[model samples]
Target: MTASKISFACAPVIALLGMAWGIAMAISTDHSTAPVHAHLNLLGWVSLFLMGIYYKLHEEIDGLFLARIQAIIWAAASLLIALGIALIHMNNPVGDPIAAVMSIVLFLDMILFVVLVAKSRQ
Candidate 1:
């Protein structure tokens, strides 16, 4: 599927998962994983959905290989960061390294997005 389609398809699923997670936390009265939930919503739902809309509006760049790469990387990194944060909250030492690396990956994905947007006609 196209990058835009992939984004559109994945965003809602991620959002639903995030919402469920939030509700679960609320029920359990444990907010320690709040950061992970926030990251899932922001990166998975907000950022992905916004990028999908942008791709939809700007057809010129929608089909570019780099756009697809950016979308995939963003999605993967989002999940990775959330997992890392969750693990850290669980007191796992490896979580720190995972979170650190994924954070950089997410940042680089955003940079790739910036380049794609800058190069696009619209």
Candidate 2:
């Protein structure tokens, strides 16, 4: 499947998950994991969906290897960071390291995305 296709498919699923998580938090009256929910929605849903739209509009870069790599990395890092943050909020010290590493990975992935967008023909 094309990178755009993957993005389109994954974005909504992650959004649904984020929405469900938010509802659960609200019902429980515990917003400690709000950061995780926000990250999941922003990075997993919003960012991926936007990138998918960009790829759809720019056919030239839709199937580029770097674009595909960026999409995959974005999804993975987003999930990992959310997981790490969730764990940290639950009092797991290990999540600190996990989140720290994923944060750097996510930042580097965004840099790659910026380069891809800058170099796109359309």
Candidate closest to the true structure, highest TM-score: 1
The lDDT values for all models are 0.92, 0.92
State every prediction's TM-score relative to the real structure: 0.97, 0.96
Which residue runs does candidate 2 get wrong by more than 4 Å?
none
Stretches > 4 Å off in candidate 1: none
Q: Estimate, for each residue in 1-122, the C-alpha lDDT of model 1 and write its tens digit.
A: 67899899888988998899899999999998999899999999999999999999998989999999899888888888999999999999999999999999999999999999999986
Residue 51: error of model 2 in Å? 0.8
Q: Write one digit per residue (lDDT tens) for candidate 2, span 15-72.
A: 9989999999999999989999999999999999999999888878889899899999
